[model samples]
Target: MAKKKSPPETLLLLPKWPSSAPIVDTHTHLASTFEAYRTRYKDHATVFDMVRAFYHNTTVEALVDVWCEAPVRTVWREFADSALTPEDRTLKWGGIDYWFVMGVHPHEAQHYTDDIENDIIAAMSHPRCVGWGEMGLDYHYDNSPRDIQRSVFRRQLVHAVKLGKPLTIHTREADDDTELILKDLVPKDHKIHIHCFTDSPEFAQRLLDYFPNLYIGITGVITYATNTDTSTVIKNMIPSSLRILLETDAPFMVPANLYNSIPELKGKRLPISHSAMIPWTADFVAGLTEGKWDAERVMIEARENAKRVYGI
Candidate 1:
């Protein structure tokens, strides 16, 4: 007779955040995150449904979702519009404050058109559209030609600057060009978000020193063992400076600590990251601070920094 196989351990529910500190995810992709969830579970899940499932017991207060496609996703309007009123926000997003920034990501720089630029400019006037971008150089993939990315980046920077909108920048492995272009084009006092930074500590310090108002958008990537730059940057930052912003950059960079926190997960990975996971990111960040910070303190500081940057 053959021996019977044992069933695998059921995944445990996500641990509840230990503090009342409000979570403000400075950058995320809500629609894409929803798609990831639907694909993973093979279920018909709406964005709000995914939100409820992930954000249930979390202290997620606000999210600055990115809409950076070339043509721009029409679905963005529905989300930005829905959060116009308290009742609608409660009904649609479970009372979580939702805001967005619109622009063409560097990966889509080649496809950028005048019409697309016009569309992004119009969105800047939107009551819920807080800033411009998720835009800049990305040499890691070089999905678009270098020259085209630089040209489109400059054009968008000009527009965002003219409109006096805060900037959300994405730079990967092109630190020199990114630094030069930003320093030449953007004013020192301009509100800039260097989203998902994984570059050298020197590059981070240069940006931080040059642009006092500029913030480093820290994502779950910081918790990964392979990237010490993000951790080092956090450790070196003067705690009183308040230059870090907590974000998940979700549907991506799900914090590795999450797996360790829940033993039943058993080395299995979660298919998606969301705003609710901010605390885990904060917890890891707390660990990096040499007992100077806690998860709640990290959340609170990030929340205040988000307001200063995005004014949401």
Candidate 2:
């Protein structure tokens, strides 16, 4: 019989925010892990895997889950239930308190229909739904035609404005068009955030000038030494912590520091990203600010900004 190989050592050197850090991951996708598990290992994936996948939530005080596409009914139900149930056991499990935003992603803009709109509107009535979006243009992919993406985004913007909810925006490579749409459709006083902001410093300045309450969402991508554009803007342009929101964009932009440094997570079929990675991001942001802002200060400001914008 072949001898069983010992498990590879997983590095645990990534920074951990204190339990009292008041951290709020302002944007993330929650259903990816379960969905992947269901698709690949439906028979073998146990409840334990689901729990382990979500065990990342232990790192943050609260989270803003973004539903960019229509989630299966059960996932939506579970999210709503988590928001309503607040027992100590749940809390001990690193039960993250949550608020959500829903909208059509630019890649899926062509698939948008009245039914989808109505479904989103109806979901807004759920006690946990607090904003509208993850919607905007993706000139890079152009998965949906530019015109169609713009039209779908505008319709959602109108609905969000009328509904009195904040906007969770997604703009990439089409900064001018995104700025034009926001200028034309969104109200000046409305709460708007550029989630996973990777735009130019000039564009950041333009939006900051145009929208008094606009906030920029920062994610673990900041940990990458190659991502100079965002790092430069964070370092030189955005001086005030008040205009920033910390996010994982998870199951997506797992930080370089966390991704490359972690030992146990190595040799995975795919890299896993989670809200628990936000502290690594917070630490990175502190370094970018040259200690002008520490991890605690960044987390505190982000929490307050999330509360004010999302009305949680």
Q: Who wins the lDDT comparison?
A: 1
Best candidate, TM-score: 1
lDDT of 2 by residue, 1-312 (tens): 984332321222244445567667888776774454455444426433453345553555677888887432446656666566577326432466767888889999998999889888888888888899889999999999999999999999999999998999999999999999999998888998899988797898789888988988899887777777778777764466548888988668777765554456555423446667777787778777876887777777788888878876
TM for every model, in the order presented, reads 0.94, 0.85
Clash numbers, per candidate = 0, 3
TM-score of model 2 (CA atoms): 0.85
RMSD of 1: 3.6
What C-alpha lDDT values do all the predictions have? 0.87, 0.75
- Model 2's C-alpha root-mean-square deviation from the true structure amounts to 4.3
> Where does candidate 1 have its weakest 10-residue lDDT segment?
4-13
